[model samples]
Target: MKVYISADMEGVTGLVDAEDVQPPGRDYERGRGMMTEDVNAATRGAFAAGAAAVLVNDAHGPMRNLLPDLLDPRALLIKGRPKPMGMIEGLDSSYDAVLCVGFHARAGVLGVLSHSFMGHEIEDIWLDDQVTGEIGLFEATASAYGVPVVLLTGDDTACAEAVAWNSSIRTVPVKYAKDRFAAQLVPVAEARSAIEAGAREALRSLPSAVGAGARTLSVRWQSASVVSHLTAIPGVARRDDRTVTVTADMPQLYRLFNLFLRVATAVTSNPPYC
Candidate 1:
C-alpha cells in the first residue's frame, strides 16, 4: 500500500501566531520542526502497519515547511512553491490512501490560527453545498481517484470538523483550540504517538469507499471585486458578491486551486480591490 500525506502547519503544536506559519521568521523554523515530527509519526505508523511506500506533500504555506533533512528517509517529500498541485502534488488513483497532518478547522472555526485558504480573502469554501475546510475538500478530491482519507491530525476543532464528514476516519488531536491563536496542546511526544496509532488504524482497516465525486471548488471571498477578478479564469462563475466557484473534470483541484486563489489573494489584498 502506498500512502500520501498532506501536511499543513496551522494546527501543529505551539503554533499560535501567523508568524509561525510564515517563512523568514523564528517561529516558522520551529514550527517546521514540529510539522516534520508529526509527518514522521504518520510515516512510521504507515510502515508499522505494513505500507509499501509513502509520499508526503508539504501542504502548508510556501509548500516548503518540512525539512527533508529531518524527514523520514523512507518517504518522498514533494516540496516547493508554485507546483501544479499546491497541497496535493503527487496524488493519483493508484495511491491506496491519504492522510492529513497538522490541519486546522475551517474558516470561522473556533481554533488556533483557524481560517480557510486565504484567511483574509476567503470566508468559506463549499463542495456540493456542504461547508468544508481544506480537509473535506481534499478528501472529496482524493476519493475521486479511489483513495481513502484514513487519518487526520490537528486541533480538537479540526478533528471535530473532520468527524462530521466521516465518523470512521481516524483522528489525532494534537491541541484543543480555545481561540484562533490559543490552544491547549498535547506534548510533542504524545501527539506523535497518537498520530502513529491513528495512521496504523486507518490503513489497516481501510474503508471500502472514499466518497469520490466531481471536483468542484467554490470559494467565498471577503469582497466582490475579488470575485470579479477571478472571473478572468476560463469557465469560472461569479456566484455573488463574495463567491466564485470553479469545476474541474480531473482530480487535480489542488493545482487549479493554487492558480486561481493565488491570483485571487494578490488581487484582493491590493488596496483598490478590498
Candidate 2:
C-alpha cells in the first residue's frame, strides 16, 4: 500500500516559537531535527504495517526542513515551496492512507504560535460552516478524494481537534498544551514511541470507505484588506469583510488550494527579518 505523510512543525514535540521552524535561527535546526525524527518514527511504523511505498511532504514553509539524505530510503520526499498542491501536495486517491504529523489547532487556540495562516492577517478559516485550521480543512479535502487519514500526531489541542474532525483516525499527542505556545512535553524518545505505535495500529487495519464529495471553503481574515487580497483569484469571492469563499470538487480543491495559499502567502506576508 502507498502512504502519504503531511508534516508540519509548530506542533512537533518541543517546538514553541516561530523562529524554531524557520531556518538559520538559533532554534530552527534543532526543531527540524526533532520534526524529522518524528517523521521517521511514523515512516518506520508504516513499514512495519506492510506499506510498500511512502511519500513525505514537507508541509511547512520553505518546505525543505527534512534532510533528504537522512529520510528513510524507502520513501520519496517532496520539499520546497511553490508546489501545485501546497500543504496537500503530492496527494491523490490512489494512495491508500495519509498521516498528518505535527499539526496544531486553528489560529485562535491560546498560546499557539501563528494561530492563523498569517499571524496578524487572518482570523479564522471555515468549511461546511464549521471553523477549521490547517488540519481539518486539509483532512476534509483529502476525504473528498476518498483518502482517509490513518494517523495524526501533535500537541493535545491538535489531537483533540483531529478527533472532532474524524474520530475514527488514530492520534498520538506528544505534549499537553498549557496554551498554544506553551506546552508541557513528553520527551522526544517517549513521543517517538507513541507516534510509531499509533501509525502502525492505524494502518494495520486501514478502512475501506468512500469520501463525501465536493466542498466549499471559507477563509475568514482579520480585516477587509485580507479578504480583498484573496479575492484576486477568479473563483474566490468576498463573502464578507473578514471572509472569502471558494468552491472546488475533489480534484479542484487541490488545484485551488495551491492558488489560494499562494495568494494568501503573498498578500499577508512581510519578508522575514533576522
Candidate 3:
C-alpha cells in the first residue's frame, strides 16, 4: 500500500510559538529538525505497517521546512510552494491512506499556534456551513480521491479535533494545551514513539471509505480588502463586507481556496494572528 503524509509545523512536537515555526530564527531552525524527526517517525511506522511507498509533503508556511538530508530516505518528499492542492498536494486515488503530522486547530481555537490557512488574515472558513480548518479541509479533499486519513499527530486539542471530525481515525497528542501559545509538552522521544505506534495501529485496520461530494466554502477574512479582491474570481460571491462564498467540488473547491489565499497575500501585509 502507498501512504501519503502531510507535515505541518505549528502542531509539531515541542513547538508552541511563531518563533519556533517561522523562519530566520534559531528556534525555527531547531523546530525544523524536530519536524523532520516527527515525519521520520510516521514514515517508519507506515513502512512497518507494510506500506510499499510513502510520500511526505511539507505542508507548513513556506512548504520547505522539512530537511531533505535529514528525512527518511525510504520516503519521498514534496517540498516548496505554489502547489495546486496546497497541504494535500500530490494526494490522489493511488494512495491507500493519509497521515497528517503536526497539524493544529483552526483559527479562534485555543490550540498552540492556532490559525487557519493564513495566520490572522483568514478569520474563519466553513465547508457547507460546517466550521472547518486545515485538518478538516485536508480530510474532506482526500476523501474525494477515495483515500482514508488513517493517522494524525499533533497536540491534545488537535487530536480531539480529529476525533470530533471523524471518530475512527487514530491520533497521538504530543502536548496538552494550556493556552493558545502555551502547552505542557510530552518529551520528544516519548511523543515520537507514540506517533509511531499510532501510525502503525491506524494503518493495521483502516477505516471504511467515507465518500465525498460537492460543497460550498465560505471564508471570512480579517480585512474587507482581502474579501474584495477574492470576488474578482469567477464563482466567488461576496457574502458580506469581510466574507465570500464559493461552491465547487473537492479538487476545484480546494484549488479556489488556494487562490483566495493568493489574493489575500497580495492585499494584506498584516502579520499572522495579529
Candidate 4:
C-alpha cells in the first residue's frame, strides 16, 4: 500500500505560538526539529503497517519547515511552496491513504495557533454549506481521489475537528489547547508513540472507499479589499463585502482556493491575524 503524509507545523507537539512555527522566530528552528520528528514517527508507522512506499508533503507556511537531513530515509519528501495542490500536493488516486500531521483547528475556533489557510486573512470557509477548516477541506479533496484520511495528529480541538469530519479516521492529540497560542503539551516521546500506534491501527482496517463529488467552496476573508480582488477572477462571485464563492470539483476547487490566496496576498499588506 502507498501512504501519503501532509505535515503542518502549528499543531506539532510542543508548538503553541507563531514564534514556534513561523520562521525567524527564536524557537522556529527547534520547531522544525519537532515537526520533522513527528513526521518521522508517522513515517515509521506507515512502514510498520505494510506500506510499500510513503510520500510526505511539507504543508505548513513556506512549505519548508521539515529538515530533510533528519527526515526518515525510507519516505520521499515534497518540500517548497506554490504547489498546485498546496498542502495535499503530490496526492492522487493511487495512494491507499492520507495522514495529516500537526494540523491545527480552523479559524474562529479554540485551538492552538488556530487559523485557516492564510492565517487571519481568512475568516471562515464553507464547503457545500458545511463549515470547515483545513482538516475538512483536505479530507474532502482526498476523498475525491478515492483516498481515505486514515490518521491525523494535532491538538485536542484539531483531533476533534477531524473526527467531526469523519469519525472513522483515527487521531492523536499532541497537545491540549488552552488558547490560540497556548497549550498543555503531551511529552514528545509519549506523543510520538501514540502517533505511531494510531497510524498502524488506522491502516489495518481501511475503508472500502471514500465518496467524492463536486461542491461549492465559499471563503470569508478579513478584508473587503481581498474579496473585491478575488471577484476579478472568472467564476468567482462576490458573496458579500468580504466573502466570495466558487463552484468546482475536487483538485480544481482546491487549486482555485490557492489561487485566491495568491490574489489576496498580492493586494493585502496586513500581516496574518492582524
Q: What does candidate 1's lDDT look like per residue over 1-274, in tens digits?
A: 9999999998776677777877776788888898898899999999999999999999887787898999999999898877777777889888998999988888887877777777766788887678887878777777777788888888999988888987767888998887777778898788888899889888988885545445677888777877887888888888887888877743656567778667876775532101
Better of 2 and 3 by TM-score: 3
Q: What tens-digit string does per-residue lDDT give for candidate 2 at 60-173?
A: 878889887777888899998878777788888899999999887777776345364455555777776788877877877788778889888988888888889888879998
**Ranking of predictions according to lDDT:** 4, 3, 1, 2
lDDT, residue 51, model 4: 97
Instruction: Summarize candidate 3's per-residue lDDT along 173-199 as a digit string, tens digits.
Output: 999999998999999999999999889
Error of 2 at 34 (Å): 0.8
Q: List the residue pairs that clash in candidate 3.
A: 120-273
Off by over 4 Å in 1: 210-216, 250-254, 270-274
Model 3 lDDT on a 0 to 1 scale: 0.90
Clashing pairs in 4: none
Error of 1 at 17 (Å): 1.9
Q: Candidate 4, residues 1-274: lDDT per residue as tens digits? A: 9999999988899999888888888999999999999999999999999999999999998999999999999999999988988999999999999989999899999999898988888989999999998999999999988999989999999999999989988999999999888889899999999999999889888985565667999999889999888888899999899989998897899999988888888988767644
Best by lDDT: 4
Please state the error at residue 87 of candidate 4 in Å: 0.2
**Per-model TM against the reference:** 0.93, 0.93, 0.98, 0.98
lDDT (Cα atoms) of all candidates against the true structure: 0.81, 0.80, 0.90, 0.92
Clashing pairs in 2: 107-115, 107-116, 110-180, 111-180, 111-181, 112-180, 112-181
